[model samples]
Every structure is written in C-alpha cells, then in structure tokens.
Target chain A: MSDAYAVRDNILTHHFSDGSGCIFFDPMDNSMVAATKPVEELLNKEKSESDEQHCHIINTLLIHKMITKL
Target chain B: MCRRIYGDRFTHSIQPSEFIDFRIGIKYPNFTRRFLKPQVQFSSEGLVPFTPLPADYAFAMLEWGMNWTVAMYEFQRVIIHSAVLAKDDYAILLPAPPGSGKSTATAYLENNGWRLLSDEMALITKNTTQVTPFVRPICLKNASIDLCKQMFSHGTFSETAYKTHKGDVAHMSPQRHSIEEQSTPANIVGIVFPQYSKDILLDIYPMDKTSAMVKFSENSFNFNFLGQQSFETNVHLIENTRQFELHYSDLSEVNAFLNEEFCK
Candidate 1:
C-alpha cells in the first residue's frame, strides 16, 4: 500500500512491502531489484504507456497539420 | 569472429556478441531470445531494454555483461560482486543500496586522487591484483549534485535525469586521467558497506567471507540468473578479501581516511 506520508526533502518515498515483495535499491545503478511481481509488471506497463504517449503525440501533430491546411 | 565466455567455456562465432550461458539467461524471464544465446552477434541497432537507447549504449551494455561473465571464468580467486574504489590500487569495495554513499564515496575518492575501478560495479578476474577500470561516471542526487559540484571544481556534472523515486539524480564524469592509466586486478585489501547518516562512524566491523558474499550478492545485477556460476564467483571474491561496514556523514573524512589507507 502506498502510504501517505510527509515528504522528506521534497521527495515522496513510498514503501510497498508485503510478505512476497522484496525491493532492493542498489547503489550500483538507477536500477533496483524488486522481487515483487508488481515491479516487473509496472516496468512492462510503463513501456506500453510510453509507446501510447508517443503515438498520441504523432497523431495529434498530424491532425493539427491537416486542420491547418484547410 | 565473436567469442562468448561462459564460466569455463569459450565459444566463438563469426558474429558480434555471444550468449551469457543458459543458466544465467533464464533468470530474467522478460529477456528476449536474442539476449538468451550464449554466443556473440554483431549489431548497431539500439536494442537496449525499455529506453530506445543508441546502438553505442546497447553495445556497451552487451560488452559489459559479456566481459563480466568472461572475467568470472578467468578469475577464480577473490572477485567481488561489489562496487570498488581504489586509491593507487589499494581499494575498498562499497556494497550497499543507493542511499548508501557508494557512488558518493566514489566521486569523493576520485576527486582526492584515487583511481576509480568502477563507479558502481566490480568484476574480478580469476587470479590477479589488477583492478580493471569500468570507469563509468559517478551518479548523484539533488543535494549531492550541488554539494559535489561546489566541493570539487574539477567535477563534471551531467543533466539531472529528473525526479524519480530517488529524487533528482545526475552523474559526474569519471576522471579521464585515471581512465587512461587504470588497470584491473588490483589487490582488494578491504571491503566496506557504506551508508549515509547524520554522523560519521565505522558502525559495522569486518564481516567474514561467507556473510560478505550473501550481502554482496543481494545487490548483484544478475546473480539469480547466473545461478551457481555467480555464486561461485562471489565465493571466490569473499575468500580473498576483508570486509567492513562504513557509515559516514559526508565525503570529507571518508575521503581522507580511505586515501590515507589505500594510497599508501
């Protein structure tokens, strides 16, 4: 559960630890290991959302151009 | 010809990149088959996961993964699966989480005349005292980004990757001088897990090899995938080095102590 807590240093830190979820934020890279199945699912969801956003932008641009041509 | 190194096996093909062994490949269920092969293939395609990165970046990722795996095979003794920083080849491995001062310490150490083995990665070969330089840039966060830039005028900062769960993050370019002259297989005399805190003190004492491996692998990028191979490599690393836990307020004193100890 995403708890509503006061921001520390203007950054909202969320802790979602159920029994099965093991999230490790390594000092190694921007990446972290989240044994939680949700983390991987979130990654995949983010990918599709980004693609959708890209498509939306292109379609909007094309529509704007067509309307301006008339 | 492309050559792939899987533990003891070195398979070669007239291709670009090779596979990372079946055992290692199986862990990342989301990974594509192209990434599954234990052989090398050629590609300039921007094939990195998620972000449509440039071909060069993808190539870098491939080279890093394969070289790391290859090194595991060649270096049978004392290869840490941890972040390493060296001052004149006397190095300390900082194995901790993001908030743990690992990259921050690296930035400080490099500024204080230390050769950076890696900003956030360590690959130990079978048997050698050479510490190779992956020499990636040191990434920092909001307060750190400003503080580091102010503390060291020689620092080169990257644009912040922007607000994430980890706050605003940026990276500092590695000292090119070190990059040019650095070597791998340096004698790992110390291993320290660094964590940032309000005051500075050495909180945890030297941990044994077995415990160190357990903690280190907990942060490994592909430990689960590499399975037994990864396990064996880490076991080798711990067997040869001493481990400790270092907690610090900031980089100033930590830099001084590490330099005094490692740089002779």
Candidate 2:
C-alpha cells in the first residue's frame, strides 16, 4: 500500500534510440520488464486517464521486485 | 585429425595445456554390434554421457561436446552465438544462424588481416563492452570445407568428417598471432549480420540501434540468465556501436567494405 514511486535514470528506465520501446532494469536484483505503451506515455508525460492503472502496473512490478518504490 | 591440425596451435601457449579444455573421455561399449561397428560416447566430469556416434566421427563429437560444455556451463559472460574478428582493437561481430556462411566469412577475415577472437561465441562482459577471447579452431562445415581449403591453402585443416549431422566438417587452424593474443580484449565497433547470396554482389543495409540491440539480445546465450547486467551491457553496446546487415558473395568486396567502414 506504499504510495511514493519514482523511476531513477541510471539503470531504472532506459530510453531507446530507435523508438521501439524502453526497458526498466532493476540493478539490485537482475530483473527487467519491457515498458508498455501506458508506461511510456506516463514516462513521456502525455495526457491519459489511465494514470492510476499505469501506476498500478508499476506498483505491481515493484511488489514483484522487478522495480523499486521511491 | 584434431590433434594433427591443432598440434602447432597448442605449442603457442606458454603453459602446458590439455588437448581440449573439457576432459571428455571417449568410450565404446562391448557387444557383437559394437565389435562389428563400434560407437564412441562422450563423458565429462559431472555430465551425463552423450549419445554414441560412429567411431570414425569421434573427433567431430569431441569438438561438438567441448563447444556444448562451454555454451551450457559458462555463465560469467553473455555468450553470443557469433563469429568475432578484430583489427586495431575494434571488433566486428558476425552474427547469423547456421548455414548463413558466418564461419566462412570468419575464416576468410581471420586469415586475411583480422585477428580471430572466436568463431563459435563472443563472451562479452555484462558490465562493459569488453569481449573475452575463447580462441580455438574455426570449424568449417559442408561446402565451406573445400572453399576454406581453396582460399587459404597454407592454413592447416583437420581431416574432413563426413555425414555426421551437418554433412562434411573440418577444423581450420587459427593464425599464430590470434592464439598468442587470445587474452587481449577488443572494443566492439560494429555488429554485422552477414548472409551469403550467390546473386548478390554486396548489399549493405544499415540497422537501427534498438533493432540491432533486440537482435543481439536474441542471439545471446545467457542474456536471460544474466538479466539486468545483460540489459545494461546490450544498451552500452548498441549506443556505442554501428549495426549493419551485409549480403555478400565476394570476400574481397566485403573485406573492402569493412576496411573502408570500420578501419577508419
């Protein structure tokens, strides 16, 4: 039920040069998940009503240790 | 044939080394059929015995078993199924599936001027762009066997083993310099996906870095196993290196193109 969440720059979020997709990498435990369109939109600061859904996805990933909670 | 071809290669090593890194003991079962036509099985430390092959093809089995051991057991580096050759500290990754003429191009490139890092795999560090050398004999299969012999006449080659899974196969001896400088690490400059085409002269297609990264990740042996480290390493590689899809028939043309592109 933690609320605060932030993606870091170093190894957390990787922006692709070819615009294919970004990947979120966890350094603590060698885990990774491909960024979905919703995640990308959130990351790019695009307008969307699915903000809670995107955050939920990230939070679920955090629960799985695929990402970290800020 | 393996011993005969790689005899001088072993001498290049300063310290005493075994004929093969993996001590695979080849044994034959005793039976009436075994006496009539013997079969050779490969067994190593802690590994179950591999299926038996005809006694004549024992050398080929040993070579394949050794390669399998490395590809399966080694997890330190992200092993890419590619042929790597280097020149002036810049490495060229030749990644392709089987029968794509990767080995032939590698053999030609190594003999011409480029130093051979490995023909089977490129052991790349997960944290950095550093590639470790697993210098061994370059395997030439099917038609490549004759082509290699014709192209590099002076190069020592093993006796051809016929009709064992991949048709005819032989081992091409690596250059003395490559063996001596086996431990030297090379920075990757370009990743080329080469395809041999009879009609094509030389078709070079540029690849996007992200697409190239996906392809590289797909071709890696332990990319999934290494996880985040593999991701970081791949990202580092794609960001810093050029990627291409080269369809070539002529070695000279390919060599010239590589020289013009990477050597500068």
Top candidate by lDDT? 2
Error of 2 at A3 (Å): 20
Chain B TM-score by candidate, in order shown:
0.66, 0.91
Candidate 2 true-interface contact recovery: 0.38
lDDT of candidates 1 onward, in order: 0.52, 0.78
Q: Model 2: which residue pairs collide?
A: none
Please list the residue runs of candidate 1 whose C-alpha ends up more than 4 Å from where it truly belongs after superposition: A1-70, B1-48, B51-81, B126-130, B183-185, B202-204, B259-264
Docking quality class, candidate 2: acceptable
- Candidate 2's displacement at residue A63, Å, is 17
Off by over 4 Å in 2: A1-13, A18-21, A24-39, A42-70, B9-21, B29-34
For model 1, residues B1-264, the per-residue Cα lDDT tens digits are 012111112343435564433122212223453354422332222232232322223323343444455444433333344567775557677777767767667777777777777765676553343456565556577688887888877666655545544676666766766666554546677777878887656454655444554577676655544444554455445555666666678677777766655566
Candidate 2: residue A53 lDDT (0-100): 63
DockQ (CA atoms), all models: 0.01, 0.28
